[model samples]
Target: MDAVSDFDPARYLSDDLLERIRGRAAAVDAGNVFPDDDLAELRAAGYLAILVPRDLGGAGLSLAEASVLQQRLAGAAPATALAINMHLVWTGVAKVLADRGDDALRFVQEGAAAGEVFAFGISEAGNDLVLFGSDTAATPQPDGGYAFTGTKIFTSLAPVWDQLGLHGLDTTSEDAPRLVFGFVPRTDAVRTRDDWDTLGMRGTQSRTTELHDALAPANRVVRRLAPGPNPDPLVFGIFSVFELLLASVYTGIARRALDVAVETAHARTSKKTGRTYSQDPDIRWRIAEMALAYDGMLPQLEVIARAIDERADHGALWFAKLSGLKHRAVTSAKRVVDEAMLVAGGSSYFTRSELSRLYRDVLAGQFHPSDPESAHSTVAAAWLGPVDPA
Candidate 1:
């Protein structure tokens, strides 16, 4: 057994539930639709509020524990895990702030406990500024609340997100260019476009969301800060939790691919050698290589997650480390999937094969935030300073 199997951080998800999720994954992907059944089961299991405080009707699991659960959930159904991750990100941020004695996001925790699904509305089309800035327009009202009007892309959990945790630029206030982070309830002002046709992870239905002056009430308006990078806990919480959870999803894909490959090897017999592929040195070595790639990720994820849980204070280097971890997890998972496909042979080429789905799903990993380019940039700056401002 791998080290990951031995360490369990979250125990909310029963093995039977994961098996059911796995059973539905193929049909969900085949239909290019949301995993509604999976969502219902998870919500019923109290999985949605895993990060909210226990007193708030949640399990009150730490971020580290939630990371492990995401990995497990992703191993069964990446799309479902990915969609639910959006909600968890908000709740995780709330937990992180609460751990540090800040309760500004107590509403988020309470909402999660009350079964309100929160979706991430940060990504914008061609908006590389991600989290630091927003292309969305935020106008303040006399009552102190703000109305946001803009398009937010990749809005996961589209079919069911009760509120959107989004950011926009407030250019009308005395502060002029402050970034306003707030929540908008599902209202007439908010519209979701059913345009989530993608190569893989289709079950997520991560549609584009358009906001037409969607209102975030005064109490729900969370953070207000300057346009670019700040040391606020909300920023830190979002970045850290988002990156780690994303990494765990890809890592789970890697684990699933490797498992399928191993199973294929044992069951398949080689015509050339008149023996099982598991006995073939080449197959054994390939599986070993996949395992090796996967082995390194668990420790990094666990350590980083524990550091966040313990508030170890890595300081300025935190962003770089988080990005690097995500970068490696994605790239490594891709590599493992590639090798697993080769090991599984011709059957993996068919779209129906689990490995084929894994291959397609893994491709989506590189497209997420802290992508390869930005990740490398951050690491380079950490080591040699910011490219001499060239």
Candidate 2:
């Protein structure tokens, strides 16, 4: 059975589905390949529709429930999990825009349901976690549509994404700094360049996309929309969901590493002591520390999840609280996985071993925007009181 069968938010997350995803995890990581098969499974299982309303052919599960399901799946396969994460983020934002009478709603919803993947085109040119960059211009075409011409790096799922959730500034209206939010279809004009050969998340296929006058309707673009900003109530809820669930995945991978290490310990003897390595006190302590780290992540995640549910009736302050928990979960998960690797030593580095891939996969968790640095400014600003209207 799936680890979260009874409490499953949507019937989309099933034991059979997880098994299929797990089978591909190692192969994808080893070959540094996208998990196309796993994504197909997710589509078939309706995971893509978890947040969509039932009237719209979705499961319509709440933020609280969805977090539980995501956490379970992420604990097993993080690459696939992260890929799915982008989908939800874009879809959620699109849902709101559509409700705001944005013309692109129908296409966005239908496109997502049809497996037309959308890459969240955030984190623009020259972006360094502080300043957002984008020299790529969006100019109006005489045909009433806009032509998007720019370059975006670290574009996740770009290789297969059919649409892009683009963020840009509409310079045409000088009176207002119109921030454009909309979908850009992957037409012949959209070119992708190889760029995302990173130390981790290599399989995300996070390439750089170059757009040259991609055509789209005026209604297809909504100006003055922020994709996802800090301190929003949903931001905290989603951040907690992301950090804790990713941590859970690392913890699961670490447990697997620990399992392999213990089995090896039982079979091999220490060269100096002439005794099985499993019997060594130092070795035992290392194993114990790994377990402690793994065990700690679960309860901590639960605490944050529960808080989000309770505060849903209120406004955004709860999200700020969630940022703290997210930082802790991400940090603890990295430490656990690191220690798990140490227990296995050089053997864990072997390509044939599962621990090798698990180690590499867990490292990606560190850079997943879960740190306090991202949220410190926002949370502190809220605490200091509101500024005057200048």
Best by lDDT: 1
Which lDDT tens digits does candidate 1 get at residues 6-62?
445445888899999999999999999999999999989999999988898998887
Judge candidate 2 against the unseen true structure and give its global Cα lDDT, from 0 to 1. 0.63
Every candidate's lDDT: 0.92, 0.63
- Candidate 2, clashing residue pairs? 75-249, 125-133
| Candidate 2 residue 252 C-alpha distance from true site, Å | 5.4
Alpha carbon lDDT at 250, candidate 1: 90
Backbone clashes under 3 angstroms, per model: 0, 2
What residue runs in model 1 are displaced by over 4 Å at the alpha carbon? 1-10
Q: For residues 1-390, write the lDDT of model 2, one tens digit per residue.
A: 123335544466777778777777777877777888877777877777675656677776554455566665765676777677677666555443343454345665666666667676655555543112246666766765677788777677877787787755556755434445556888898898876666566667777888787766676765443333544322333344445445445545555556667777787788998999789898898878877776776665565545543443335455455555556556665676666667677877786666666667667665655345655654675577445679
TM-score of each: 0.97, 0.77
